[model samples]
Target: MANGLDFFSIGGADAHDGARAVHAWHVIRWLLCGWSLLVIPAFYGELTSTSQGALTIARSLYLCMFAGFALCLLWMLHTSRKPKAWLAHNRLDVTIMIGAAFSAGWGAPPWQTVEWVLRLLFVGLVAIRIVLSLKVFFAPNRLIGLLIAGAGVLAMAGAGFLWLEPRVHNYADGLWLAFESSATVGYGDIAPTTPASRVFAVFVVLLGYGMLSLVFASIAAAFIGKEERALRHEMHRDIKHLNAEIVQLRAELHALRESLTPSSDAITDAEALHSVPRDHH
Candidate 1:
């Protein structure tokens, strides 16, 4: 995925540059989505079974995702006028992709360890991309989209528990444990026993906490926004009413001045006429 900071420059000085940036962004976003879809199933398959067929499929999917990442980088490079700058901004992506490629290619036992580490890194990168994409593209109902994403992540974590946690015999129990762990409720039931499951539980707990906090913040913001809008509407209405009253008062004052002017002039003329007649007599 393109750097989130670069997204703001989609409208550049040149129209063609802007168009290329937008196209690159869309291509990267879609490719990231596809990689996410492929990786989830592959990860689950590898987690659940050690069969050669399952391993083959998972490997194939991983290769495809890696290829997609390379294609995204290439697309951005080709479309960008500032190739050096693009590379500079995306050093993390380039490093992850190179690491993934090296890990997949090397055959040593130590390389196997590197492969797993790289996988974790790639997963983290994808998670960040998913969150950023949801925020940028789903602006109209961002909160709802984020909630759905959080639920999906938790559900997948629950599925992981089903395979990792021996105590989680059934899918429902796995979900229960996942939720309880994530919410920090514990409930003294369905705890993870295996080291792998415990580690997975830690990940679930942290991810869930962050996502849940975001959900609550979004809800509060929505309520606060509604209150602000209502207050603004009331203020506008009161201002309009005050303006109308001021206009009416100004009109009445003008009419009162007009009405008094002629009467005052007639009284002055009568006084002058009486004073002149007395002088003539």
Candidate 2:
């Protein structure tokens, strides 16, 4: 985000060492990543069999993992000397990432009901990170994957509800009815005919199409104009500067060799004679 004003430059301290310290901090953070990937599956496995005591332990571990990740983000902010504007932009992403990690760890309702929400947010975080890192236009194709996945997800939720609802015949029917009506094609086999279900259907129709358009509708309009082009121009400028520095370095090396060369008098008579004679001689 605005690359913060080279904090090391302002601090008047050894920037390299500061950079190394950040590197070391990142190493610790990734070690925790490894620990989480290893342990979280086990914790998730226990969710069904475990009593509240065990759930508490699992949730504690989950929360701590997220807290550790957030600490790394905080340290990055501390090391950066950027203006508030830059920090504000960057912090949104860090906050969202942390929030999603926290939700994945412990947040819930019946999970069946709220799972769609969690998955949407979770995948959204992934999409944002991917877009930020790549920053390239697959456009006239800005992004299709997120939209396709979201639609498919809603459809799956609908189909799943329809298949599973009849046994218990409670809220699942409402979910199936909602997505079905949202897509604007409902089967009489599963009737929502209730007012509450009709309202839910209306909400889903609005939310579904709106979200779908929000993600994919701009695919035809990605243009890398002035500001982005300037970034590439700056990269070219840096390359030119490095080339000049290399040329200077080579010239300095040639001068050093010339300075070390022996003068005529310093060369022994016998050695001088043994060397190749001039054409005039």
Query: Where in model 1 is the C-alpha error above 4 Å?
Result: 1-16, 36-57, 106-119, 137-150, 245-281
**Clash count for each candidate, listed in order shown:** 0, 1
lDDT of 1 by residue, 193-275 (tens): 86557757877887788777878877888988999999999999999999999999999999999887778779899989888
* lDDT of each residue in 121-162, candidate 2, tens digit only: 543443344333323332334457556655565765465344
Worst 10 residues of 1 by lDDT: 7-16
Please report the candidate that would top TM-score against the real structure: 1
Per-residue lDDT, model 2, residue 138, is 29
User: What is the total number of backbone clashes in candidate 1?
Assistant: 0
Error of 2 at 7 (Å): 25
